[model samples]
Target: MSSIPVGKGIPVDHVVDNTAEHPGERAPLVLNMHEFNDVTTTVCRVAESRRVPMAWYVAFVFSLGLLGFLGFCIAYLFATGVGVWGLNNPVMWAFDITNFVFWVGIGHAGTLISAILFLFRQKWRTGINRFAEAMTIFAVICAGIFPGIHVGRVWVIYWVFPIPNQMEMWPQFRSPLLWDVFAVSTYFTVSLLFWYTGMVPDLATLRDRARGKIRQIGYGLFALGWRGSNRHWHRYERAYLLLAALSTPLVLSVHSVVSFDFAVSQLPGWHTTIFPPYFVAGAIFSGFAMVVTLAVPARELFGLKDLITLRHLDNMNKIILVTGSMVGYAYSIEFFIAWYSGAMYEKFAFLNRAFGQYWWAYFIMVSCNVITPQLFWFKRIRTSIWGMFILSLIVNIGMWFERFVIIVSSLANDFLPTSWDVFIPTWVDIGTMIGSFGLFMTLFLLFCRYLPMIAMAEVKAVMPEADPHHDDHASDAKDEEGGANS
Candidate 1:
């Protein structure tokens, strides 16, 4: 248990022997338990602080206003009917469907960042995984709300599912809408479980550290008596691994199923086989952009620069670039195939998307998603806080426009020329879309204020000092030198 001298060159065998005797010795000899504990304490201290800024209050107020707008829109829609929006005969699925797909696509980035990156052993994810996972859950909640209300009666929305009824009328499994019901519902459930499971250990850390009675009770109950015991850690690790594996496929499949709602149909632009991968890529692309948009500000606001470092931002930016490129590729392929296939309807769909009524929307999408993300190849741009923040916002805007272009342009001009008509969204349509943003921000702000946005324990686990090999390297180097000398 004897400690190594501070400055002297201790024999490599001596260091190794001591490390074997006391596994928690300081670096160069063993793991630095003290440093790990100190880092964890510092993170928790910052996270638990009760001070709220004036900006947070302003944001909360604005969010409430948006929520009020949502309430008004819903009430109007219920009283007046779905006719309040711009859904006409041909363009039956307009802004409502577009918004649903847009939000659902936005939700994909969170799970991809947390689960997919975790599976790849990306240590930087530890910094923002908790926040990203929370974003996934909240975004899904936002996404789920649209489709629920999109079906005029809202009350009859539950009929999409199979329930115990005397009539024995089961939802048609063959319908894409029914598939959407199952896909979105399953995604929400799995994401919530994944998010909550990750939070349990962190909640326990908060519970043990909390001073206030309310915090103690709240965090304690959520922690489920997690004590970081070896037994519990063993089980927790296995469960987490299983959940991540399960979620990865769900992330891909849920959005693919969603895309099927458009792709499986005989609509000129919608019938392409590439829709599944294309939609999933677009979803991840936009989702990552949204994650960056929110995370960059939250990390700065919460003074979490050290925990959510430049490394984490760089990784997220890289994802955005890759996915954006994939989406761009899909767009090009779609156009090429449309022309090469010699399908008159398909050719017209692509040409119409570019030069049609919604030409501006198509250009906005290309510029925002395809062109802007190309900047990420430069390390300086991706790592620069302001550069990334601006790019991320642009990406979100572009992705939204992409959906607008796809849904509106395709439906506005179908097979029959006599039936062709341009679709325009009413103020109510725009209001509700903006209101969903309000809901998402409101929930996010609450999360930042109350919960530990950064996963403290997980971050600590990934720190350099926590690596058993980090210090052992020095000893190993010395051992080789000693062998040479002998």
Candidate 2:
């Protein structure tokens, strides 16, 4: 194997020996890294550098423009009321709700990567977990915006809370809509805490290495005085494990509750026992795709290809395949259940989704969410950088259409044919949806620029050098000492 200098005087194979001779041996999770300090240097260099990449500036400016457009759309909605959206009489929920659910699903992969994989001891997660976690925070932020603005009375939004009011009215506790508030809010709070807590060590590294007083103080404040002492490491591990445990249930529950927004409703298409699990699967499906979508450009743009390797991309693609299959199965079963029930309303709901006015949307959803991911069955596609990246984008687009088909199609043409109407999204609706992507990218790019994009401490833990047995000097010394004693 070819060697690389991980640190001064520390030389090791950048890529582990996984040739035909070592069939049982595992490949390294972190390439181009063998020393613990090298991991720190590799990750921290991006945040500490003064020369900004032109790609970052270009992306930032474009995202900022979208964010500004989002602000304008929201402001216009406030002034003109919800009528500005393409929402019609029966289709009261359209792009706003679709975007809300889409963003919520986008957030799920982060917690799954950080918490679930951590619990299961999936070491490959070290490369992508921090990125995914940050994505979760930003995505949930985008998701939260819709619920606040979708309600026509934006000023009276506080009424959703249980605070005492002059009218002596409290929020309807039994409402599924109210449950969403608790579920999403709790998920965001826990996720934010988990993301920040994991960053504490890396933040401290940045704090210590920061060139200026302002940077040191900024990173130090959030680092919470994290010293690399035995006691500090102990507490950090304990806290991280606890937060991971706490976050595990949120991954399944948050989206399940989000599904409850539709499942609990009396509408034929909306009411179903399958939505909870189905939504959870689709959430993970879309979430992982979003992670890959970000990871591809991120790895390329930031010169992190060595840290975020093809193996990481391949593993994530495998997951996208699994969840995409689940989503496909859910789609098939929904149609089957509709047929088996012999309920005309349910039957029409499923048939209308495919043959109705919005059939094009349904086609796009199935094509993107189901057929696109199936291509990953080929090893060549999964390993190909451009192939997986394009597929991931397609999956995200399909997932968004999935939400659109579920909400708009069902609501647009309900049991009462007299009330049926075609829901056409106005420019405002399209722009707002586009603008949420702007908001997500804006937050994510800032995170990449200022913060440690990868977890320094965690990445080191997965390196070959972390194992005491892997040190040649220690082994050689032990052998020499044994010979002398003998």
Candidate 3:
């Protein structure tokens, strides 16, 4: 391993092993300390620049417009009724729940990257964890909107909460629907805490580097008095580790509860034992796809290829392949289980999903989620920016259609012919979903503009300089001490 300098006053021999360079000429994760600091300054300078970049302004404007439209849609829905959404008999949970599940699934990647990877001591996570966690927060916000408004009378939306109301009702504990409410909300709260808590040191870095007092105080307040003191870092590391541990199970539980919303139901296509792990795997797949989809452009826009690195993108693509294959395996198992059980409804539901009126959706899901991702098995595709972006989008599309197939197909023509009806989403359904995209982009754009998308301090911590092995001053002290003390 190559020797590297470490944190302030830390001895050379005490350096961590994680900072060791790869054998046989692997490229460095970062260039040099000056270059690393320059990258940090460049990110902050984007926030401080008096002139907003033209491209960013255009995107932000469009996102804000969509948000306005979303607001209008909600107001109109409240004034009119749920009738605006095209939801009808047997298909009450159409686009609304579909969007809800999709966004929630998108959020899992962030927490998984930040928490699970941290626990495993994956050093590469420092490059993208901040960006991914921010995405998680925004994605959850987008997700929460669907369920909140799907209640129709938006005024009474609070009824979902277990508040002792005028009606004296507690939310049903047995219903997975109720469990979903708790799961998603808990996920959001913890994610937000974890995201913000992780940002403090980076925020202080910005605060210290701020050119103007306005920027200084603004970053300072968010920095929460972080001063890079050894004691402060000690507590910070402990807290961060604790949060990471707590967040892992919380992240896992959110999607598991979401799957239970379907698995607990007696409906043939919906009810299945495999749904928990299946949903969690699919969530991570879609989440990584979304991250790749966002990061490829971001690395270009922010001029951050050195920090984000091709290796990061390559690793993420590998995950996408793994999880996408898991999802496909679940699909096959569902089919086999349906056949093996000899239950007519289950069997019919499985056949109908692949060959019934909604066969197009099922096939689309298969193509997008399963077939397209198989391209990444080739190193050429995984490393290509354009290839990653296009395939990521395709995966996202397929996952959405996967949910559509499950939600609409099963309900549209179930065993009970009397209750069966084809579910069709209205203009509101389409618009609202579009608006959710708008909302997601809006938050992300603002985050990129104002916050350190990469965790600066965390990145520094992993840099070669922070490894005491490279600090000759510290190394000499140890040698001298050994000779003198002996």
Candidate 4:
């Protein structure tokens, strides 16, 4: 039998007279072209044959229905006015502001995991990073929609932009609203650019792997002639690193600016110094929850169990636990400071949040965000699909209630008892909020169905074979020693 040279081009054939004597030191067999083809074929067959679960279909239908309800809400709001919702004198920022904050907070996790974890060099992030990035972009899209429409004059939303317009009115630099305009817009632009850039390499992979003209053309166009050449990789890597650096600060600042909208105001609950860090923490907490919610199902559906292993899930749960604890700490600190400061307004606002007209919302927030994640301390719980799934859903509920409690409780009981009235959300308010869920899920489902849910190349890059040392001198020495000793 002919032998193949491995390292130094020395060839030897039929080295052992007795075949049994030269029993090869069996290193783990690296996947070759044939194995890759087999694996790909198996994956394609399974993906094609497996029926999408009834639950996804049900969710898709329900989400679409909710999206339709959102459309109806928009129409009603347009036809009648902004007065269809509960916003009124003294409580000017109600449901719209709440929804805006909620969605923005939801958008935070995607960027945090994608950018921050990337910066930190977490190899496991490769499994879910792309999806998280997509989530960030979509969540921002959903987030940007509410604040724009909430202004009542949606057509004139461009007035928020500092472009040279016919009106020649520059948006007030002093206004937190203006800061929000810059912050959110910059965030969306940077995030979209980041997400799109990351997708290019993956899109190219999909394009090459395409079966038909349609997919070839579509993915090719999106991929922008990527060849994965060393030059392209070099440039791409630099650009990604630069973007990550830029985005890191924006992640902290954007939410801080959002918080300024409340904290800058002299209103009791709104005027807290803790709002910036508190808002940022809550955003990250909710964002991570949303990531897990989408990722768990996507991993299962796409047969990415090997790529997104239990280790990844465990890591995500740890993040959830850490961030959830941070949020809980923020909640405690807020309460402590409110009481210790001996400020009556601050005291009243904290009291009202916990035991006021919307005490249920506050309790829900605590139970969902703080109490639920405490279960992650158990390794079995953290790794269990059902446990993570339930916790993620609970986190979503808790986060929503957090926004609700912050917005409604603060507004419902102001300094003037005369002006304090219970602010109930109208049907329009309810519909739009529910519709946002539909919008998010619909986009997410489409992403899962179409996209290469796992970052194939990145995952490969992190695997043992990718390590230069994996099959080098030490491994060779061990193999030779074993062979010689045998």
Candidate 5:
């Protein structure tokens, strides 16, 4: 196959044709793309197209229903009381805290992919980073809700903050709960800024391509006067780099601090040195799984298979496998530590998790979080889109259960057997949990409809034509065009 010319007016059809001819060849990260403009066109087409996919409408309607249901649940919760939940004497923290931790963990993969991978100069991140970043923001939004409302007295929720008032009330500085307020809020702020900063160049592209006044103004306002000049590019790169570096530590620290909510407790299962790393690993594990969950459907629905190719999915699966292994190891080590500490209470706690009244939840957690991911070791499974998609869903379910097992089990069967009782969730608990998913999907679907899903500028930067010598090829093509015109 002769090298395809890189310059404008050089037809790129042969590039796709040649790629098709060689079926077994290593696939390009951005498949079916030879021209720089193709990346912009392919991505922008989704947002700019007049006719939306029927599936998107179906999904949007479904998501809206769930969002409305979430609103209803919140209204009821606020109107009634915290007693509407399944919170008992032993299990004061049930679905609310469980959902909070689960959503927070869900947001982790976005930062890890956006910040950590960016700092490492991983090019594969380009195809999916926008999705992950959006997910991080939405997931954090969902995560933030539970903490605010979980307290019975929603009116006094401001007490969680360090703000002073006429009464001279101050938040408990040493409390892990208060730390969550700072950590989650800070993480959300940085993630939101990081997400928007990266979208500016792409927003400018949309502004330029807009055929209507509203689109031009809407996209233009957010584009921040991006002119694609050398100075603009330089400043954008510098700011993006700084934000990426800033976001990297938060990926580890945010989740680790979240783990402190449990680890700092003196309860048998909750108190442990391993919770920090263990929680971080599980967060990434579940986070990447969610990216897969969202990516598979979005790519399929939006005709983005060429951009978010199988290689990207496969790479994400490998990360899931690695992190899932770490999670499984953490589970085992928890039990080992319990035995090694020479404490009967700790041993009982570990044993109780595996073989207690809530044994079903633990089994599901292990099976979904631990055993299911092991299937990715097979190349066939991870490479198959549906296989990985299904596995990703299972992994997320297991992660939720993992949080449930950690919180509910530990709290339910504590020191005194007489005080121990099973916590049964009300209809409100189940509805609220499902409603959060609705809220996440609804925000994500709206983003897909309006914003550029793929990072057009970043994707183009990674293309072969972006290489330095590609300009020489363009010069040759230009000379050929000049001769033909003459």
Candidate 6:
């Protein structure tokens, strides 16, 4: 095939059929075979020799401001104590736990896309999985902050660990909070290793293409002397596959453990057997929305629209719709169980969640999570960059409210009418919540500046040229015909 120039004037029908091995597969970028090598190199240039673009600088500076605000709030929180926030008798676990669950839920989509989808051989994940995993790490970091501070008297927070002390006080092995400590920490550690391990080859590529000695050495340390030899590739591939296998179970269990925080509780709205599945679905739903929220902006700012394509956005929207539906089903089931079991407290708790003082929260949760995502069913809406970005943000807002409703609404009306007290957030509560975003964005910005945003090695692996029989299609067809004649 002759090399046809791909330009602004080039038509979609003009794309070269290099995907012969995987016929009928949709190309995320729609590059012709002639453009593949150059385009692939262009994709990695940001990590190689490219200078910092103006937009990245602006974003990084803005995120740094948020990071500074986060620091101030945390310092103030430590100095003032938990009393500074809006914690009362019933709402003791209100906004802090709500933010914890919200951020943790936001991290779930990364593992789902990276480990689970890879295990299922989904090639589409190759483009976005790297940064999604990075976002998960940042999110888990944000998630941990609220709980650590909420423990109040942050200096003695180490008491939760299994370490021995002079008083012979051991940590409770059965606590859901303890379970969250173990679960979130383990997920973060495994995810970090998984992400860095996947980046080694790409890091090596960057190292080889480094323009200066300092650049080469900086990338070299993480590249681990990767020579890209067959032996090196063999070991790297096995380790990655092992990590992927391990992470799949961790992804499910981590959120299940998070759900235990609610399910193990005897509180009327909290003690449901269906919580594990419900939380897991909601986590993935929210996580995908957050991913789209981050990815849409980053792609445009970095000229990465070709890599993170409209198709990718569309597919992610579909996930938001599906999981949002699951969450809706869980809501219906919870209401049904409340009425069917003749549990007045359970019935009253849910009714109060929708109709009491915090009715606005419940409405926001339902509208944002369940109703808003249904817009993605329209192809034009899902495929539009601005449309996807706005909807994704809406989903994020809805998911946050979902956690708020679960934590605050339930606690605001406990078993005894006398014990019931309306929960309200103070500035400290609001500031800490807002600051967590700053912390999250700070880490994510650093990631984009220093590391390969997309998984260059994996992306290339999924390309049409990576197939062994890519160029021998016609010859293979002839061989098959000859064999059949025999």
lDDT (Cα atoms) of all candidates against the true structure: 0.81, 0.88, 0.85, 0.77, 0.89, 0.82
lDDT of 3 by residue, 1-486 (tens): 223323333232332221233343223444333335656775676676778667888999999999988888877888898999888888889999999999999999999999999998777788889999999999999999999988867887788888888988888889999999899999999999999999998888888888888898899999989888999889989999999999999988999999999999988899999999999999999999999999998888877776787778888999999999999999999999999999999999999899998999999999999899999999889888899999999999999998889999988878887988887778888889999999999999999999988888887777655554644554343322111000
Cα lDDT, model 5, residue 401:
97
Stretches off by above 4 angstroms in model 6 are: 1-40, 48-51, 474-486
> What is the TM-score of candidate 2?
0.94
How would you encode candidate 1's per-residue C-alpha lDDT over 244-303 as one tens digit per residue? 999999999999999999998999999999999999999999988988998888777766
Model 4, residue 297: what's the lDDT? 79
User: Which residue pairs does candidate 4 place in steric collision?
Assistant: none
lDDT per residue for candidate 4 within 353-380, as digits (tens), equals 9998788899999999999899999988
List, residue by residue over 1-486, the lDDT tens digit for candidate 6.
Answer: 336333222233454431222333344333432345554465666666468788778877887887888888889888888898888998899889999999999999999989998888777788799999999999999998888988877887898888888779988988998988999999999999999999988888788878899989999999999887988889888988899999999999998999899989999889999999999999999999999999998888777866776667777888999999999999889989998989899999888988998999999999998898899888878887889899999999999999999888898898999988887788888888888898898899888877888887787666544544545552333222110000
Best candidate, TM-score: 2
- Model 3 misses residue 144 by how many Å? 0.3
Give candidate 2's whole-model lDDT: 0.88
Q: What is the TM-score of each candidate against the true structure?
A: 0.90, 0.94, 0.92, 0.87, 0.93, 0.92
Those runs of model 2 whose alpha carbons end farther than 4 Å from true positions after fitting are 1-23, 472-486
* lDDT score for residue 413 of model 5: 93
- Model 4: runs farther than 4 Å from truth? 1-56, 165-167, 473-486
* RMSD (Å) of each candidate, 1 decimal: 6.8, 4.9, 5.8, 7.6, 5.4, 4.8
**Model 5 poorest ten-residue lDDT run:** 477-486
lDDT of 6 at 450: 78
Any runs in candidate 1 off by more than 4 Å, and if so which? 1-34, 468-486
Taking the tens digit of each residue's C-alpha lDDT, what string does model 5 give over 56-89?
9999999999999999999999999998898999
Candidates in descending lDDT order:
5, 2, 3, 6, 1, 4
